[model samples]
Structure formats: C-alpha cells, structure tokens
Target: MAESRSKLVIVGIGDDGLAGMTESARRIVAEAEVILGAPAMLSLLDGLSGRKEALEPDMPAALRQVREALASQRAVLVSGGDPLFYGVARYLCDRLGKDQFEVIPHVSSMQLAFARVKESWEDAYLTSLAGRPLEAVVDRIRTAEKVGLFSSDEHPPNRLARALLDRGIDYFRAYVCENLGSPDERVTQAELTDLASMDFDPLNVLILIRKPNRPDQASRAGRHRLFGNPDDMFAQTLPKRGLITQAEVRSIALAQLDIRPDSVVWDIGAGSGSVAIEAAQLAYQGMVYAVEPEPADVALIEANAESFGVPNVRPVPGRAPEVLASLPDPDAIFVGGTGRQVVLVLRSAYARLCPGGRMAVNVVTIDGLATALETLKNLTSEVQVWNISIARGIEQMDRVRFEAINPTFLLAVTKTPDVSD
Candidate 1:
C-alpha cells in the first residue's frame, strides 16, 4: 500500500499579511509545523512560530522544499494575493496534484490595481512580463482598449512603456500602481510617452487605458472599406508598386478562403499588408499574420495595418516557411509573393494548415501557375483554379474606354479530412 500524504494548506496573504487573512486561514497557518514562502512574505508572520523555508524564484528548488516540508510536518505554503493568479500556488497544485492541497486565496494585486484606476478590467487584456517575450505581446496591446500588466524586475514599467512608444503605440494613458494595500502605496498616471522616462517601485502593476475616441496614430488618408478596396488605396512603396494583387483578384481569393469572424489567417509575402489588413477586418475577432522578408515591405505592412484600424494584423518581418513554424497553424493562407520558392512554401504551409483549412495562391506567370497547381493538387483533391482578367472603364475624349489589367491565376485548395472519419 502507498504511504498516505500529509494534507497541505496553500494560503494567499496580502501586503496586510496576518490582518488580511481570515480566522480559518490564520488558524491553519498557526497550526502548521512547517511554512514555506518568499523570505519577505515569511517575514510578515514573524509572530507565528514554524520552521520557515525560503521559497526561491527557481521553481525546481522551491518544489524540492515543498516536498521535504510536506513529508515531515503539517505544511502551510504562503503566497501573495490569489494563489492562482500568476502565483506560486498554481505551480504547487500542478506538481503536487490538486487533490492533495487546499487553497485559501486573498485578493490579487491586479484586482487592487484595477480598483485603484476605477476601470472595468473584465474586457481588459491582462498579462505578465516574467517569462513571456515582450515582442509577442506588444501588438496585442496596440489594439486593446485597456491592459493590465504585472511588471517584473527585469521588464519594469518604464522599460515596457518605452517599448510601447518605440512601436508607434502612444494612445494609452498609463497608470503605475505601486505597493498596493501597503503604507507606501502610490498610483501614478500619465501619458505612455511620459511614463517611459520615469521610474517606479519594483512591486507594481501597470494599467493602460486607451485615450478617448482616439483614432489609430498611423496615417489614414485612404478611406476604410471592407473587402475589395481599390489597390491604389494602400500606400505601397515604389518599384514594388505594381506587385500588389489586383483588387478583383484579392476579392475572389478572400471568398475562396471562406474566412470567419474567428479564423486565423496568414498572408505570406504580404506586401504593404493590403490583403492581410482586409482579411483582419473580415476575421475581426481572429488574428492575421503577415510574413514578409524585405525590411521596407514589413514597415509598410505595419503602417497599412494600423491605418486600417486592424489591430488583429501582426506583421512578421521574416521569410516564409521558417517563420511560419513559429506562428499558430492557419485556418486560411494567402501566398502572394513566392520568391521562386513556391513549392517549398506551399508544402510547408500545407503541412501546417489545420484540417479543412483553405489555401489561396496567386501566380501571374505560366511557369509559376504550373508549379502552384501541381503542388496544391498533391495536398488535396479539392483544388480550384481561376483566371482573373479585369478591366476598368476610363472615359476617353468621346466614349468610355476599357483599360485591361494583366491577367492573374488564383489556385485554392482545401486540406483533406481524415479518411477514417
């Protein structure tokens, strides 16, 4: 028979410490023969006697201490705020199994921060900068009406605010709430730019609320239209000006994509981000990733996405195939510029596409079309090809004249479902 494990109580304490804890929670801590928590959190309960084990930030060492303490004595683990809200209690529960422990949660610091700002955080984007890369989150912040951030020692409020400013995001009013529920608690509010240059206490939550009725900071001379906006509406760089997929072709490809409000789409070689921006608007509740290699095109993609007020579009500045690996698998993919790596990109994309996902590739040259059709046909039997030839009526001196644009080929494929199904 297996040895019975001692019951562990994980108690969440606030800055007020013992005073903030409930009578039941205080009793549990008082009866514990061993207690584990951060050194600072342990210091708050100096009045209660127990064998105190300092919980290190290193998770492995902390878990080792937890196991040793629980094996020999009645253990009570102390954490800050709600033990599960980005707290140590989550890790303990996962490692030790939820059935082995009881959790007593206090109010989280994030909750207190939101309260201090008098803002509703139900719809706000909440995240922490402890282990997550800052780059992965900055784009999400660009479109959020409100955001709550738990600042780490390495990525403090000032550094985060500066990072936001550098990305052309300056519409949010910043609030740094420091030392919540403590004697030195302070709340500082300012513009994001101003917040970037200031310092704050190490223990703080940074809240950002967008400026009232503020339009996107990026230029928006072009009118915002749904799918099928004219090609000239986008700000494309010279030399690559004529390379954009014609408006008509884009409209057809989008239809074939069968995009939904929550579909994840990819616009590979997304020059000036025209297609990606439009797709983002279509997938309003979803995400669109624009992958481009040239530095200039990447900048244009970002500018265009912002101008269209589509915060869902993320401009990934890198080549396809390789960069596609990092992104979430797509529900729909549009390949615009292949750089003669059409086969490689198609195969990689087809492999990563979710079941029943759609892929649309446009090619202007016969050789390119042949390769695309052959490649797509290998992925699934449901392949379609369209020859798009569009002309606009231009008023001549005496009559309306039709100006023909170059013909393009669009090939679409839907991934095959499981045969067993």
Candidate 2:
C-alpha cells in the first residue's frame, strides 16, 4: 500500500523569516520533506533539514508545482509577512480549495510598514504590486489618504513615485520600509518628488501618508460641499479645459434630482465627470454611472474618480442610451447634453428608470429645453422647470459687481401614476 500524502502547511514569515518564527512554526519547517518558497524566502532557511524547493516567481505555476510535490511527502510553502494579508496563503487556498491546506500566519509587512510610519492602518488603502498592473496601483493611490503598497520588481518605489508625480499627484509623504524586522531594516522618508529619484531594496513596502492642509490629491469624502468650492477641488482635464460640469449647475441638478444618501444616478453626458463626481459624494452608498463617448473624457473621469476617492462612480466609455442598457437601472438620471437627440435620449433613459425615479435635464440652448420639456411631459405628470441664471460677485475697486453667466434651463420630472387610464 502507498503511504498517505501529508497535508501542505503554508507559513507566513516576517522580515526575519524562520529566525523570527515561533517554535511550532520552526518545527513545521524543519520536519517537512519538501519546502517551497521564493528565492528570497528560501534563502532564509538555508542548512535546514528539509529538501528545499525554490518557488518560481509565477504564482500559478508555483502553486501547481507545490500541489504535485504535496502528493508524495510532507510539504511547507513559505510566504513573506502575513500569509492572508495580501500574501500567497489566500491565493493558494482559493485556487486549490481550502480543504487541501492549512495556514500559519505571521505579522504582515504591510502592518510593519504602517507601524514604522507610526500610522494606524485599519482604514488605510492596502494593495500589492506583485503580479498586478501599475494602472491599478495608480488609480487606488490617487485618492487614498493612507496607502500600503507591497513593491514588485517591475513597479519599484522609484517607478511608482515617478508615475504619481507625472500625474500631478504630490500630496503624499512616502515612507519606504525595507527588510522589515531584520537588523539591516531601514525606513526612508521623503516627499513624492524626492522619492521619484531614490532607490530602495526589492523587499520593501511603500507607505504613503497624506500631508495635512495639502489639498487632498484625492477627492474629499462625503457629500455637502462648502457653498463655493474652488475649481481645483474637482478632478478636471488639463489643456482641453472648461469641460468640467460647472459647480453651480451640478448643485442645482443634484437638488432637482432629489439625491438621497443611497440614490443610484447616471450622468449621461459626463464630460469631465464633475456632475457624476459630486453626485457620488452625495450618494455614498449608491452608484453613479458617468457615461461619456470620448475616450479622453473617460480617462479624465477615472482620474477624477480616484482623485475624489468616490468608488461608487463607474466611468462607462460610451454614449448614453446605448451604454444605458448595461447599467443597473438608476433612481435618478442627470442629462447634461443631448447633442440634438435630446428627446430620443431622454425617452430611452426614462424607460430604464425605476418607478418613482427622478430625471433632471440641463440645457443651455432654448431648442434643447423645448425638446426636454416635451419628452419629460410624456414620462410623468409632475414636471417642474427652473430657469437658473447665476452671477458671481466680483470685487471691482470698492464695489462688488455681478458677473453674469449664460442662463441655463433645468427641466425636472418625477414619474407619477397617470390619472387617466
């Protein structure tokens, strides 16, 4: 009869690896017939009794190799830091089924990284660069007040810092913690600009803590903006500017839409996504679909979404009505532009709206307003229109003069039961 295969043990290692492991953890590693780990992880267990197997950098392939070895002898798979906290333990269990393995966790380097920076990480944005794209990292970092990143070979600290700086994200004070828990452990602190040119060890965690009073590079959290927020308060496209939804118009449309804390909304002509961005804050638990046809505008919307730290707003790169088919049916729809298809777009949007949903349309042209009113009347019995003309008070000499902006028309409609039939 063949000998029964022993269960695989996945052990989390600190910067000190086996040297810092508990007695029980050390016993598991010493008795294993085959031990699997990355080159760096394997280096920590040199001259150990077990036959060491260096794991490949590719995780999926390494997992398969580990499983094959487990079929014969006692096996141990080693990982850096806490195995479940952005470490390999979760991936192994998830991929191979939980019944196949047992996990022994240690303090995560992310935790150590935060500890070294003297910041609480319970609410921080934690992510890893290992095997993930840089774009994902950049997007997450854009609005995070505190971020803990597990650096990768391709996306080292310098590369990450440069990427952030190039995108005009400079509000963070970065701390790079290397060889955590080891005697040679070092933590380097610098501004993003300064870090862009620096070098650090491959085994490092990058911690970013936002500086106080610096305009949060990311969007502010929660709804209820101060009456007059600076234009820079929002994430807007550079160069091809003035495309952001004007703050005044956004406020009016949001009010007309009757946005609740959890109201699902769509900004059909999202442009630079200012309307959808603000609406995301107001509807924290709700989702906002910022639909735009232009690719560049979609990119801007994504940047703005990250800048504002509003994960609820999803940027859909396509025209309205066409893209509307895929979105979760919305409670409110803000139509920013119709491009001569005002009636058609409004009618289609209303059809997809949930019962009692609100629709608000903003039109600068008289023709667009006429089309909006006609379309809105067909959808519901209750229709309200506001001709909003806003003028900012400018200090000229000793007198304050009102600088008038082009008047805008807001058409708001609520779905109500038709009294007739």
Candidate 3:
C-alpha cells in the first residue's frame, strides 16, 4: 500500500465552463492558491482567476508538476467530467496513495451522451478509446446491446466503426453526439455502414444501440476466467448473489492484503466465501478461515471450497468479533460487508493482524468509508483508499448489456512493525 503523501484536491470541470461546475467545485477552485490543467481546461476559468500553470505536453512532466504544485500549496488539479471514471483520478490514485487527495466530480460527457439519445445508461457498457486497446473492447462490443464510448483524436468514430465491421459483428445502430453542451453540438444518427465511411467531430461520444431481435453469440475466446472468477462461477444463492464480494473487488482486496503462499489469513464477513477461496488459491500452503454467521451460507462456503478443490479453507460458522477470538493470529485480514458492526470487527481483526501484516476492508456506504478510514488511520499511517465503480457485461434475452454494481470503497493499511524485535 502507498503511504499518504499530500492532501491534494482534484476538481472535475465540464464543457459549460465554470457554470457547469457544482457550487462546491467552484468554491474549491476559487479557494485554491494554485491551479494546474491543460491549456484548454485552464481557458475555461475566465473570471474565476487563480495562479494557474498549464501542464507540460509530456505526461511525466505533467505528473511531476502536479506533484510539486500539490505538495507546495493549496492547489487544485482541474479535469473534465467525473475524475474517477477513466480520468486523472485513477491514474494519480494508483501512483500516489488514494488517501493523499480528495476528489470532486462533475457530470461526465459519457452521461450526457446517453441522455441526448434518451437511453437509460444504467445498463450500457461505457468505455473510452483514449488509451484503451482496440482489441480489448471489440469482443465486449460484439455482445453488448448498448455502449457509450468516449471517442478520442487517435481512435475516432470512423475507425471504431470500421473495426467492428471487419469483425463481422455489425448489428448496432449508431449515434454520434458531438461537442456536448456547446452551442454547435450535433447528434448524427447513422447505420454502422454509414458510420464507417464518415468523419465526426473529435470531441464526440459514440453511442451504439443494438438493432432489435439480434441474438447473442459466444466470443471465440469462450467464457474466459478472470483471476477472481466471475460471481456465477461460484455456487451462491439468489439474494446472496448480489451480496457476494464481487470478483474484481475481491481480487483488489486480496492484492491489498498481500497474501503470501504461507500466510495465515482471516476473512471476516466472508459471505459466499469467494474471497477466502481465492486467497486459498494463492496461499496454497497457508490456512484461510471463512467466518460467516448464517449456517446455510456456511454450507455454501464449504460447497464452493470443495468445488474449487482447495482444502486449505475452513468455514467458521459464527458472527465476527466473537468467532474471531478462537482463530489464530493472521498475517493478513480481509473484512467484507459486516454493516454497522464493521468498526468492531475491524478493531478485533486488526488486533490479530501480525505486525508488518496487512488489513483490507471493503464498504459500500459513505458512513462505512468514513468510519473505516478513521478506525484504520488511528492504528496505522500506511493507509490507502480506493473507490471502485464497475459494470459487468452479461447476456440477457440473447442480447448483451451491463449490470452495474454499486460503487464500493476499499481501504487497506499496513500495521507498523514492533521495534523491540
């Protein structure tokens, strides 16, 4: 986990200039002693003047400048749209610890694009072509019914359309929403073939809605397994399916825990026990305790463990804090949705985390994020935070679209080592 560096503030801006920014965003920018952004982004700050520095064209130079500005003064790094969604926040947070900065987001252009087409975006597969590889999103698009893509100067609408056509998977009706929120904004409706032949404004959103009655086809790759296998791959019950620690999330949490092959691990609020199972995969020689309260779910955990064929995981049937007492000290710990008692569970779990070990907690509510941060920060300074928002693409009624998992915050910290040793 990365250590907290500076208390940096990042504010998201939109095309409507400062008017588009929230009152909170405006105030943060106003109070900033120094502001840093690209030339075009800085141009939007017409009246709300501050000592602003235009970032250098080179990415490394830009990051260095941002680090310096943030470290030296009350600086705001301005970006367009929700900074966490494929924006500067993810990049910066990954490099510098998430606890170092505060993020304020604006309505993203991707959201506006979905709105312009009058399509509800809750199920749309959204992505940006700015830095993503073409092949990566192509297979996903082959199965999706609706997609909202942020087109870049390098991978514009025409090129994207052409690539899809070459794949022999062309059922989408296209909409190019250009220069959104500007006076000269345009929305061009066209077929896939028409889209392939024409140019679009560089600043544009490409929306793809599948033609009606189109059936889904399996990707040539088959149901490729993810590191933290998909939710369905595990044997989980109905309402519990929704409650299971998500595959990608557990993968992240496991990474934060830094579990080694011989590490003794404890998973509080283990739920369906996917996190414990995956941890068992890594800690093949180690022991993983799946601590759950419900008896039926405890059986499900054992079943899932058997299916994975990992004998290292033990399902402990009882509530946390109390059940935690019987367990051995842990080299690493993972706490899932323990709800209101999360603080209690974390306090007890942290006590068992061996010195220089790691603890990672996953929470869904703002209160959880705050209280978890407070509890962990009281114990260790090597704290890192991540806000994960993800959508999974699944086939429905022979067509594919995304099912969004609610936003989650992951907080991980490293316990300090004992000096006497």
Candidate 4:
C-alpha cells in the first residue's frame, strides 16, 4: 500500500464549483475523507462522502480539525480562486510545513475582474482589504493607473469610493465585479461619485481605471513643461522675496541633475519650494521631498504644490540630517539656503544619495561655495562649478538698459559607482 501516503491536497475552486476544477484536482477532492473551506466554498459541492468543516471566522479551530483529520485520513483544503493569491493556502503552508501538502491553483478573482472589464492588469496595483487600513490603501491608489481591490464587508466598494472621493481623488472610473465565474456574474461600471453611494455583493472585486489623460490635467497649462519655468511664475513668500532661485541658475541646476521622469529628488532648505516644485514637475511619475525646517516655509511649499497641481511633491518639516533619515534615498538632491552649516548638510546628503546620483548646491557667499566645492570634490571626480550672473532688460525712454542680477555660484557633482571608486 506504499505505506499510505499522507499528503494533504489544497485545491482552488471557483463559483462554478466542481465543474471549474481540473480532473486531477477534482479527483483529489473526491478521494478525501475530510475537507475544509469557508461555508460559501463548501456549499458549491454536493454528494461528496467527505466530512466538510466550515473554515470562516474560526480559522484556528478549522486548522486544528485539518491537522487531526490528516493524522489518519486523506485531507483537502478548498479555497476560492488561486489559493496562493491573498488566500488561506499561504497561511496553512506556513503553519504546516511545505513538504506535507500539495497546492493547485485556479484563476484568481483579480485576474477575472480585469478580464471582465477588458483591461490588462500587467501593472495594476492589487491588494486585499481584509486586514489593511482604508487610508493607507487610498494613499497608494492616488497615483495608480489601474487598481484591483479584494473588498470585504467592512471595507466595501462604496466605502472605499467615499474615502477616495474625500481625498480629492476622483479621476478613476470604477468597476464592481460580482460573482465571478458564476452564471449570474455581473460587472458594473460607473463614475467614482456614483459608485460612492451604491451597494455591492459581498463577493466582489473593485477595479479602478484612471480616466484617460486625467492625472495630468490639473497641471498641464500648455505644452508639456518639464523644468526651468520663469522664477516669478511660482508663488513666493511675502516679505522674504528675492530668495527664490533665478531662472538662469534653476535651468543650469536642473540640467545638471539630469532627472528622469521617475527619478526621486530631494530639495533641501526649500524656501517657498520653487526648486522643489519644478523638480516635482520634471519627475512627474516619481516623488520629490522638500525638506524645510521652518513652519512658514513648509506651509508655502504645500500652497505652491497645490497651486501648481503637483501631487508628488511632499513638504517635510524638520531640520536636516535628522529629517533626511526618515525620507527615502534620493536619485538627486538640491541644497539651497544652508546658512552656515552648508558643509554639514552637504556631507549628510552625499552619504545617503544613491550611486550615480547627482547633487547641485547654490551659494552666494564665498565661504559657502568653497566648503561645498571641497566636500563634493572628495566624493566624486565628476564635479563642475558655474558662476551664474544674469541681467534683465529695463526699457528707458529712448533705450533698453540691462541691469545685472546678483551673482550666484552653483556646484554640481555626480556620485561614483562606489565609495572605493
């Protein structure tokens, strides 16, 4: 009798029940002396000789039952759709050693939901609401192109839609897919506002597709502008005027950063967040952290971010080196208004920047410029410095006179592939 193999079989079934399972999976389920599943999953099958156990809510009790059953008889654990995809199979396998069981998967409900809506989910953000906070999930969905959510009674589609709407995220078209793979399956499409007040079946997948070209509509003034817009174009703080970076220097610094569409950037000592805002625009698909210690400056950054409709720029309030510890590592960093601690901040940022990333610093004093240049030279061989002096034309009665703007120095460097190099 080959010593009676004691393998436990885990099969993924669907609303279609036995008809949905493969021949091998069906045979495994039929031969079992004991089976475990949620009440809805167990209700799908009939006329089986196995003793069925309801596995919802009281999972620990069900696991104990499965363990006792496996001691003397063949056991099978049934689940809806792919058992490995946000299902109980992973938990079971983790608790009951991998060698003791065999897993067979079916098409996941997320896959079915996308298929029903005729959309590709190759890059969709997919997650289950069973144990996640609604706010955290909504924040993740803010910039997603497509999202698939496994909703529970506690966090249903309507509740999720209302949360999203409250966050000013109304750019996605909503789809509620119910009873997937069953004869009475339904997929309902509606705008986010409409979906916020509607009801859905307990067994449903929520799909959100971002409206076509809607994400950028808030910021697209005319033609796609990446960086180096006029300095006056940004909202500056009152009374602390003339502190923003000039357009000429901003252009040079931006070119030096060599930002990609998805590059992560940090603008340290962000005064009124002009550089940070422009960097945010250039790195539209990525995130930009504007680290400013002053409360007023932090407020200005947020106001400017809203006015420009750039959602990716986050205004961080705190002193540097300490604050930088909490922020994500950056592909590029821009330091301005470092006061007398220019070298300290520069060294801290340099230590955290990713390899091949760039840093650009603006200085008006000779002492600040010298310190930055010296520290950057020790980090990499690809260091460049430029002295930017601009002159604006003023129309007189008979002629145009050019008045020179104050001179500023910009020091830019690229980190080596490794510290040893």
The best candidate in terms of lDDT:
1
RMSD of 1: 9.3
Residue pairs with colliding backbones in model 3 are: none
Count of clashing residue pairs in every prediction:
0, 3, 0, 0
Evaluate model 1: give its lDDT.
0.85
Which sequence of candidate numbers ranks them by lDDT, best first? 1, 4, 3, 2
Residue-by-residue lDDT tens digits, candidate 1, 1-421: 9787787788999887888889999998988898899987898898788888888777767777887876755899999888888888766775556777788999999999999989989999988777544654575687789999989888898898888888788889999999889888999999887888899988899999998887664433236678999898888999988789888899999999999866789999998988998898788667899999999999998888767778778899889788987786678999998887889999999887867789999999999999999888887876899988988999999999999999999999988765653
Local distance difference test, per candidate?
A: 0.85, 0.80, 0.82, 0.83
TM-scores, each model vs. reference:
0.53, 0.53, 0.52, 0.59
Candidate number with the higher lDDT (1 or 4): 1
Write one digit per residue (lDDT tens) for candidate 3, span 170-217. Answer: 889999998788778899999889999999878789999999998765
Residue 98 miss distance in model 1 (angstroms) = 1.1
RMSD of each: 9.3, 12.4, 16.7, 11.4
* Model 4 Cα lDDT, one tens digit per residue, 1-421: 5566587778999899999889999998998888888889999989899989887565456667767766756888899999989898776675556667788998998999999999999999888887454544676688799999999988999999898887688999999999999999999999989998899889999999998887622223344256777777777777877878887888889889988866789999998888888887777656789999989989989998887767778999987877887776688999987766777888999987877789999999888788888888876776789988889999999999998888999998887655232
In candidate 1, which residue ranges exceed 4 Å CA deviation? 1-3, 216-421
Would you list the rank order by TM-score, best first? 4, 1, 2, 3
Candidate 2 lDDT, 1-421, residue by residue in tens: 9787677899988778678999999999889888988888988887788888888766546766877977956889888877788777766765456667889988888888888888999988887776454654676688788888889888899999998887778989899999999999999999888998999989899999987776645532334362224456765567746555567877778888888755779999888778887787777656789989989888888887787666677889887678777776678999997675777899999876766678888888888888788878877777899898878899999999998767888888886533341
